[model samples]
Target: MERSNNTAVTYDSDMQSADLDHLELDSAQKKIGLLRLILCSAIGIFVFFVSVPHNGDTEIVFSIIYNKLVGLMGNFAYWVLVLIIAANFVCHLYYKYIKKGSCQSAFAKVYDNDSVLHTLLYALGLVYVVLYAMKVNIPGFEGPEIIVGAATGESVMPSIVLGVLGIIIVGALFMPFLLNYGILEIIGALLEPLMRPLFKVPGKAALDAVASFVSSSSLGVLITNRLWRKNVYTEKEMVSIMTGFSAVSIGFAYLVINTAGLGHQFVKVYGISFVLVFIMEMIMVRIWPIKKKKNVFYNGHEQTEAERREDTKMSLSLIPKGCTRAVKRAYIAKGVPSEVIASLKDSFLILPQVLTMLSAIGVSGLILANYTPIFKWIGYIFQPLLILFRVPDVAAIAPSLPVGIAEMFLPVLLISGNIGAISVKARAFVTIVSMVQIIFFSETATVMLATKSPIKFREIVICFLERTIIAIPLAAAVIHLFF
Candidate 1:
């Protein structure tokens, strides 16, 4: 009997030791994760948010790296892009014909999942790049002077296509540090109170807005779409965030201001634009399309009332709670190298499709704005508002307002000649309007469409028009008040 009791005690002691070891291991892992989260999130904040002087320009570290790469590559960068497009074309052909759509490779899946129209666009993009790189105009297929102009090609290739490629690659490589390392959880927890009441979105969405302001609008959409896929946001929230908050980066805002000849008033104009954009977002989230979207997640998960309350429960210890969440998330996240590789793969998979869409749709829009009367006719709709605001050069500037839908920069280009003649107030108004009316076919719109988010092209157009209409009066008021 005594022997039996001793054996049982020995077993109990062994079980207790095992439990203690497991507790020790888990505690160690949590500590390691906390350290990782702090280090990685710090890197992300510095890279995306902190602006430093580089080659006489104050810009973020990401922009510095991108500009340096562009400078080093010079004309060679165009050729590299051509090679990437050509490779995508071959892969598409192989996926369609050789493999008969049976291949399950990630590259094949992404490149082959295009409609016939998109396939044609991809082909056209290849031709466009080849012609531009080789400086050869096709004999029988020469379209218009503007369509075939060296200036036009330069604008599309370097300004749009190369910019997208560079930003996506660089942004993707560094984004894991921000996204996979638990910064969102910490920020989301802290901002939930304000975000829920003002924007009707979770606080994590604040990070998306910051990402767009600091990096590129496309990166913001990418982050939002990724979160949606993971069921972090519902469909309604995704659409609202994409349409409402995915603003252009500050650097691009400066470019728009500079282009409008309002470089002197950049600080003032951008400051007003910053406030106006949020106003538009607050209103936009409560209107059509966005307000009408379903609240179900991307994977069809619905949050019960109980779950929602628990997820959003506020407490006095928010700082500690946020830190705990961050550490827990970090503990489960993939290693830095693995996360980065995965992010790069995601970027590459979408690169071909996005670039092709930008080339085809962007060029078409530019041509329409530069050569056609479609936008001019549309501009007449805004004539009443422009005239009501007592805006100068009403006839000339009205068209620039609506042309922003085609390309954000086209508005400034259309009015460039009048920049010297227009009032500072007028120039500031146009610059602010262009920046606030964020949906443009050339970039942000194309990037949004390329994502798996459920935003239709029609919806994007409606959102653009809505934003323009809403922004005009508000922008005019601010410009008139300040100027």
Candidate 2:
């Protein structure tokens, strides 16, 4: 009996061990599956969004696809964007004025302060839709086609749609891989010392700068807002990044250069742009308003610096250290699909706001520039500065300078129209200054205001002036030296 009992016990123990091994195997397979999904998705996003070596001119893979879709869909794609913006208008109107108990909901509270202005803006958006989409002509209020053109144009809407979609695909989908795999942390670790010392910000800020340069500045602010919400960045740091470092992307830089008839001067102009922006960033963060910003994280937590390399022997090898950190991060990252869905939801919520604000400010500002002398009135402030720099056609150039505050591309458009009036050096100066100015209501400023970050309109306006002031002479010097 004892011998029989021992045999049964040993068999049971063996079966239990086999089950444990099988369970581990199953877990390992799941992890591998997830890792593959993340890596493949990341590679696909990078190939599509990031520029690659292509015949002479750089083109993003998705832009080619988007242009084709727009061509195929024709006016349908254009109307679709208009309708989407109109829908946003309707929803905001319902929440602010029509819906039952709308005020009780969190959504309504967001527009409580500016519901009237927003309603008027949305109404104007719908009008512009009619003006541009249907080609409706109204007497006396003869449209400033250039101003409303941006709101209802093929270029801007397609860019906005594709940008949001890119955020969903690249940011939502691939971010886990980038974050989990230790790309960000390792980058943070490598650059922290320099970033913190110069900008008074953490090394992770390098990612924001790169994202802004490669992607859009608005997207950079979105990432900064994300980090701020996650308590990775404090208010001061987030504000510093959003206002100072988030210049237009390389792609947009190319657009401004091409539009301003400075494609020949691309290399020098582009280099001067980003370098001058960085130098001004260091100055901006150390000055007023930005300097007075509260240094507390979103959740009231203090951001502690990453531990020094001396704390761990693995830190001796940068690659191994980064890989180890990435592995740990990837292990804890949220599931891919859920994260992507969350990103999509966030984009949808922000779409109407972006369209409304961008449309309102873009149209009105363009009107002021075209029909009124407000830009000229504002031009006086920049007149002396332009004169000091010896920019040709100072009166013409002065008005163009402040118009960029409305839209970055506006300055380029103005320069392009009057290309014969300004020297090559002045053109180069305008191109770099417009890009580095960075605070345009049509996109960057509007997006920054939408974020929960500590930036205010007053502050943004101040930063715009400061950047323009700082960038001008530096850009002029570069133009004199190189152009």
What TM-scores do the predictions have?
Answer: 0.88, 0.80
Q: Write the per-residue lDDT of candidate 2 for residues 22-74, one digit (tens) a residue.
A: 22213453465347445744664574357755668776654444445555655
lDDT of each: 0.78, 0.65
Best by lDDT: 1
* Count: clashes, candidate 2: 3
Measured on C-alpha atoms, candidate 1 has an lDDT of 0.78
Cα-based RMSD of candidate 2: 8.6
After TM-score superposition, what is the CA distance of residue 422 in candidate 2 from its true location, in Å? 2.3
- Those runs of model 1 whose alpha carbons end farther than 4 Å from true positions after fitting are 1-26, 93-104, 111-113, 136-145, 148-151, 305-315
Model 2 residue runs over 4 Å out of place are 1-49, 52-57, 62-73, 98-114, 136-181, 304-321, 389-393
lDDT of 1 by residue, 1-483 (tens): 011211322222112111222222257767877898899999988887889977786788977876666668877776777888887777777777678778788777774556666667778778777766665333464444565464466568777888888878888888888877778778877887777767878888999998889888887888887778667788888998887788889888888889888888788888888899888999999999898888887767674555344335467676676777777566566778888898888888888778777777777777788778999999999999998987777887888998888788878888887777887877778888999998998888988887646888899999999999999889888877898
